[model samples]
Target: MTPDDDELTFGVEEEFFLVDAAGELVPRGPEVVDGTTERDGELQRELISSQVETATPVCRTSAALLDGLTSLRDDLARGAAARGLRLLASGTPVLPGSGHEITRKPRYHRMAEQFGAIARSSATCGCHVHVGVADRETAVRVSNHTRAWLPVLLAITANSPIDGGTVTGYRSWRHVLWSRWPSAGPPPMFVSLEHYENSVAAMLRSGAMMDRAMLYWDVRLSDKQPTLEFRIGDVAASAEEATLAAVLIRGLVRLALRDVAADRAPVSTPDEVLRANLWRAARDGLGGSCLHPESGELVPIWTVVDELVANLREPLGASGDLDFALDVLSRLRSTGGGADRQLAAYRRRERLTDVVDEQCV
Candidate 1:
């Protein structure tokens, strides 16, 4: 049986960069990962030596999710500090780094060998929120329903404005860098479960991806769990920002499940337009405009955010996250989201280290 909206469990996976006090990316991910105990969630190594990842335990309530993320972040921060390093949650590195080093894992080594430069330069960090679903078929259908909102979510959590010691002029430079992979970016509007599987098979056969695990669409069915994973947003600047993204994603998934149950067709946004909207979101973040998901008309980014909250009001309320979500949204509005805050810090001191310092927490 399908679970009730309030009963749908979700988990968040966040990737972080390890940097020295001067904000330079450092190859200390292994030390930090080994030192940090996974009390609330698992700590894992990433493709690059300077990055580590955390996955929260499945949580059924917004409060529980917040607590799990907060605890995990605290633990990871302490571990980094113990080794004279700091944990940074930004999507891209703020200051210049020595170079990328592929993790010693065999799978990571194989990826670097096969994909060459694409795999070598891909050290971007992102936040993935997995919302429980009944099955893979349901996950596929829900992905179609959830794809249109990805651009808005990306704009909300844009934190990687600086890259290689200079502002990239794009809000989410990580997204642009991440898109270089053949399997990355927004997933197509799948017609059915079979269609999704066939597409994956074709990509593997054509060498576009090495395996099913490389289906790095912004939204996809999880291969390791029974959930629909939303992989659009950056690793947010704080636990609260990360929690806000997870809550909003859960709301989106809940609403999609309702639409599926009602036999409502998912929005069939044109592929070209969807990709363009994503680029716009990455370029402007929340300070500029985005194309309305349905209307295709350019509107202030906050207008799209308002529409998103309005559409998810019932589901968010059913899941007991409406008030908390609203409060976070209000705070984001006042502080101007992650990218805005990062830019503000840089502009104040004209130092990328200041940007790094402000986000160290």
Candidate 2:
């Protein structure tokens, strides 16, 4: 592992949908990306023409992360408005049109051609947290160590309940849609770097994925960056929520690295157990049971989250993130995840436009 000062850094990537004056999905990604004033390569056009993405510079502190994320979000939103569209942070469009206009990029076009219907029908947006690692071996260890808790993170960040103009009955309908991809979800335990590389190479050779970047494991070693990319949760509704997710993820990675230094193997769970837990998280968010990572027993979601907070309290505090994490988790628990808020809006107005408007605001 590369030796350095005790500081660790992370970055955030968020994907959003574009909406028109009526809060309906609009295919204006090209316009927004072209016309955005602050074009520092932070803003990007995504797969769907109605979707856009933003990434933050690497940040060392939670406060910096929040500030950077908010600034980028505001700048990107303003750029969208200039194109006569609103930037929406929702995971799935409540009223997406029949057409799935693919972005005019060669890689995306090739993906659309190769994957056919799955590529065309997918418009799910998500938030990715990239936590820096010392090396590839460390990245593998951290990923294995952190896989069990991803479902808890998903429950906390559930933001897509409605998709295709219907309440899909899951808190994160985006997760369900994304799971249709060939290489999306929790990865199996990788005992060594050799095993990890070989597995990914085999997948590439099988044509299951186009390249290393398309590995799409919920958590994997990023090919282009020296970090572990966490692709577990939906795009958060607010900047604070996105930063909160990043903070918690950083804390988890720190804890995992500590375990690795102590020569401890990551707590292992069966693939079936992990998949079941992920499904439960998507279905119920914080409103139902969560599988206990240590015992393989079902417990109330609050219990699982509380235990996670307790376990990471010291690491978060040491990095000056504990207070912010506590505040965010408390508010999240009280108000429920974004999906709950969307449902509440839908119940009050009986209109998907209102739901979209609430998300945009």
Candidate 3:
């Protein structure tokens, strides 16, 4: 790895759905990314016939991250309008059944053939936040301590409360849906990178996993990228919300690394409660209190969030990122998460699509 690879960095990838006029999901990929379809090539890539992915190049600062996201979404939206398509954000669109496969790429084809129905019907969108580390050791340390706090992050970014036209009664039904795969779910916190790699290697050897990416843990080190990728967080409605979650994650990592260096203990929850809290965060987001991922006690979600924000302030202050960190938390608390916005929109329009539409815009 080069010197550039040694520094910590952050980036994000988001997936979105393609819909057409009359509020219906459309399977139009060949026409979308071919450049002949009049679609903005910047933010849009044909994930399937009816889906696209938006990504921000690696960014070290909030302003740069925000710039990438803004350019991607805004340009994509304008392009969607020109093509008479509407962009919708949700883990999965509320529509039912069979979709199109416009991308004929071999990898996507193989994945579709392997997963079958769920793969073909998948309409999920998500915000994948990637944070860089010095090496595998730091990645493992960060990943281990990050386990207890994954639910907290999930709770705050629970934007996909609706799925298949219903509430789905989960903050991120996308997690539930994705977990069906043989290789997806939370990861165990190993004490070291060697342990982490060994565990994954064992799983791969068992024929249960296709590769490291298939591990599907809420937190995992990317095989392709030298970053600890946070696979939690429902894709947020606005770029601002995503920016908040991304920065907050960086703060947690920086703090966690400091603690680990000082011989502080790792935070881990019991498996049972961890599972339960994951469900609660999925079901309630911040509106309902989340069971403590570690202690199994009921904690007001926002209060816990506030305290976490406080806990990291010192280390973050030392780095001069405390202000942005606190500002993001304040916005999340005051403006509400994706779930909060969805419910509020539903109340106003008495419909879920309206909520989703508002989110994509």
Best by lDDT: 1
Q: List the residue pairs that clash in candidate 1.
A: none
Models sorted by lDDT, best on top: 1, 2, 3
TM values, all candidates: 0.98, 0.97, 0.89
- Please report, as a residue range, the 10-residue window in candidate 3 with the lowest summed lDDT: 33-42
| Candidate 2 Cα errors over 4 Å, as ranges | 1-6, 39-41
- C-alpha RMSD for every candidate: 1.0, 1.5, 3.3
In model 1, the runs with Cα more than 4 Å from the true position are 1-3
Better of 2 and 3 by TM-score: 2
lDDT of 1 by residue, 1-361 (tens): 2635477899999999999878888987987899888677999989899999999999999999999999999999999998898998899988886747998899899999999999989878999999988588888888999898889999999999998787899999999999999999999999889999999999999999988998999998888988888889999998998999998999888888888889899888888899999999999998899999989999999999999999989888998999998999999888898989999999997988899998886
The residue pairs that clash in candidate 2, if any, are none
Q: Write the per-residue lDDT of candidate 2 for residues 100-168, one digit (tens) a residue.
A: 689889999999988998888888899999989959988898889999998999998899999968998
Better of 1 and 2 by TM-score: 1
